[model samples]
Target: MALLALSKCYYLGNLDQKVFLNEIKEIIHFHQEHHNLTRLAYQSAWELLIYTLIGEKFYEQVIVIELHFVRETRRELEELSKCVDWKRKKVEREKETKEVIVLMRWLNSLEFFFRFCSFWNEEFVGLFGNVVQLFRASSGNHREIRGECIDFFREAAGNKIMKVEGLLKGGAIDAVLEEISQQSLNEDNKICCFSFFLELSERLQEEKEDEKEEAKRKVFDKMEEEGLDDCIIMFHHFLLEEELPFSYPDENLECYFMPL
Candidate 1:
């Protein structure tokens, strides 16, 4: 809790920048060395790191690169993912379940960062592949984790700072369409999937007119190759089965309904 409080204080400009940076460095080291910490404590430390990164001034500090923040966080998540045993019952594997929950928290934090923070560069590209891997690994169960992954993709797509090429290289299109095809998705996640696709389409449209057509063709071809037709059928069935209250604008709706 103290770590979270410190993050909040730093975000609100109540803490001196140098002091907070030094404290954050110490916390990062502590978190890395203290593998025995409770899951809740570890999660709080991650939240602190994420919150601090959201601050533009803090993000610009050399400490972000010096400490290898992206690499460390990615490695931590990858390690935790290996600990999850989906075949076992949640009660029997409580620790693994907690790890899954922590993964979800990490996803949510990254999504929030992508959405609100304008800072984007090559340093953050590796995390995109991490998100894709988590999405694929959590398939058939852990709907919450998958939903968080979709939300992350949605925000990353909409964030103008992120290039569409980065998303493509990360296999985001395949992940988004694959998630949309899952029957277990709840209404909210279904909406998020559509939003992700819409955002991707909008991002593609931002290219020069000549490049725009080629980009759209490539995405459409990829979508078709990925069984987009079946996804559309499933989505149509979903619309009939559930009375979703939220309405999509015509332009946004066209992305789905337009002839392939």
Candidate 2:
């Protein structure tokens, strides 16, 4: 209907289109009018607006519009996550499961949108916990959704604007370290976790000319203190399995593994 037309227009419009604001406002109004959009059809309509905004090229305008609904959208996503049975034992009605699937897909799109926009606000930090919970649950069976959730964390953790102390206090770093310590963790998952740490380390220490090694050393020390020696050993095994050279190209890696 009208929403569909609006979405098409916005998607086709250029970055500087003047009508974007009006369309954004109208979509927000529609969302507010139907607050509880549990029905799959209605949620699909709601997601059209999200998808449109995500695909838009004008980041400035998109940021403003996204922030407008970020809180409510996150709340709705949290509720949907709660409804999912992570163990896959509590089978939901087929229609309801389909609805949840669509909603989660919309959440995946939102995560992508947040990537280009700054999501370091207090609200986003709060939402991060729910996202992590969903990530843990999605790990059970929903592979694609789990990857999307991980990407959300990856983007947030790598965002230079994100407060390092706040992220640390939120237990994000600790959770990652713990995840890496798990023996059952796959190589790809380990790589993702390590990549986040590398990006985080780079951003956090980017300004200091000589403290990069010190920062990396602190991470290694924490990992060891947390009894992650096995994890490091596994990482070495991963490198060997990949047929990479025993020595890294970077000189700083000389002392990375130590005498363990």
Best by lDDT: 1
List residue ranges in candidate 1 displaced over 4 A.
Answer: 4-19, 29-43, 52-64, 89-96, 209-260
TM per candidate: 0.69, 0.61
- lDDT score of model 2? 0.59
**Can you give the lDDT of residue 35 in candidate 1?**
59
* Residue pairs of candidate 1 with colliding backbone atoms: none
The per-model lDDT (C-alpha) reads: 0.70, 0.59
As a TM-score, model 2 comes out at 0.61
For every model shown, the clashing-pair count is 0, 0
Quote the positional error of residue 207 for candidate 1 in Å.
Answer: 3.3
> Which ranges of candidate 2 are over 4 A from the true structure?
1-17, 36-67, 89-96, 207-260
* Local accuracy of candidate 2 as per-residue lDDT tens digits, 114-198: 6655434565565666666666777656655666666666766666656666556655676677667777777667667766776
In candidate 2, position 160 carries an lDDT of: 66
- Per-residue CA lDDT of candidate 1, range 17-110, in tens? 4556666667667767875556556656656656655646456444346566577668867987898765554456435466876787778778
